[model samples]
Target: MSTPYRFPDYQVAGDADTTVFLLHGAYGSKDYFREEIQTLVRAGLRVVAWDAPGYGISPLPPEGLSIERLAETAACLIDREGSKTNIVLGHSMGGIITPAVYAARPDKVHGIVISATAGSFSQKSAQDQETFLAERVEPLRAGNTFRDTAGAVIDSMFAPTSRGPMVDLVREVALSTPADTFCAAITAITRYQGEPNMRNVKVPALLLAGEFDQVGRPQSMQSVQQQFMPHADFVCLPDAAHYAFAEQHALFNEQVLRFIRERVLAQA
Candidate 1:
């Protein structure tokens, strides 16, 4: 059985009826969208970005974390926000989890924005899962700290051309995460089974991929949109990687703001 959902440590901006719950990807805290929050608010959105369980100031789930629990917590947060017409903007593993939130509270979710994520790990074999987890966790277990790995991780996440202060900021925030939290999150995402929920997202969804994203490559993201969400609008940002929004903040924010204004608000 799932534990009762608890509110996570979060930051709020804007005061619109459309509350956007920002779910960060692995190794990221709610701080992930610090740069874009003001812009989103200016475009008329109530942005509520949360530090999901085991990330940032929020304590690790007492019973350990899973995408399922994360979905439950998200639903509670949505309910607390008191909006029937809100958007869920999830990045990376967050993309995998957001659909579950839509399923848990479909009535409340007006739209979903999945950025730089596969939206499923169900395609991975058991052996593949083990290998994936080992490749990430074994190093941390072997005494490599976030600082040691952040540079490489961030490097791989972004294109060479995108490297700059934003990249450094991403690395710095990732460095603050505990090795234990990283492992726990990896385990949860690899073992998650949320593909059905993802496919069943009937609401409007905006799918964004990074042109240089090796993690959530353009083709992979397109496949999800085609196979699962045929109606979703898909865009691949140029000169971007895993953190497409940050790498192309102006365009990213523009797409999201436009989507909400056109697709989401019209429905509401």
Candidate 2:
């Protein structure tokens, strides 16, 4: 049986027929979308961004968090909100869970936006996964300060021309996240495989990429779009890094609003 968790909710903004739920990546929380939420509301979207269990003020999952559990938790949250239809936008690690959300509750999500993330981690070999955890995760559990990990993650993600405040916001959120949460999330992320779930997504999807994203390359994102969501529109923001929504806020907002307007809202 699938376990259900009542994770703490963070309302970013909006009050319209459609709810746009933003899911943040590892080292991030609801605050990660702080910049883009208002713009989305202005565009007539009912926006929702939450601190997933184990992040921010939210309590850790009772049974320890996993991607499947996180996805189901989001579905339950959406069900409780009672929106007839909703749009989900996920970044980085959140992207992995977003597809699972669609697969688990296709009835709830009208559309999805995948930003700076891939569909799966099963692409890597077991040795590579182990190496990833050792290099990225072990140190956290081994007592690397939150600031240490946060700085490394933030520095690698933002482009040279990225926003100062947005970068700072992410760094702040990353510093606040508990070390345990970071470790567990990375562990779960390394083992996840979303390719199968990607195949099951019935909703329209918009794949957004950053031209200078080192973590999730534009080409990889484009490949994901071609393979999983062939019909989905792929938009890449030049001069933007991993956090394109923050680096190029206006363009990102315009593109997302247009997609939700012309594609999702028009169809859903």
Backbone Cα, N, C clashes tallied per candidate? 0, 0
In candidate 2 the C-alpha lDDT for residue 181 amounts to 82
Q: What residue pairs clash in candidate 2, if any at all?
A: none
Q: Evaluate model 1: give its TM-score.
A: 0.93
List lDDT for all candidates, in order.
0.82, 0.80
**lDDT by residue for model 2 over 35-117, one digit each (tens)?**
78878888777888888988878887656678888898888878767376698899988888999988878888999999887
Candidate 2: C-alpha lDDT: 0.80
What is candidate 1's lDDT per residue for 116-204, written digit by digit as tens? 88787765446745655666777787888766865566667777787666666776787787777888888888788777997889999
The candidate that achieves the highest TM-score relative to the unseen native structure: 1
Name the 10 consecutive residues with the lowest summed lDDT in model 2: 123-132
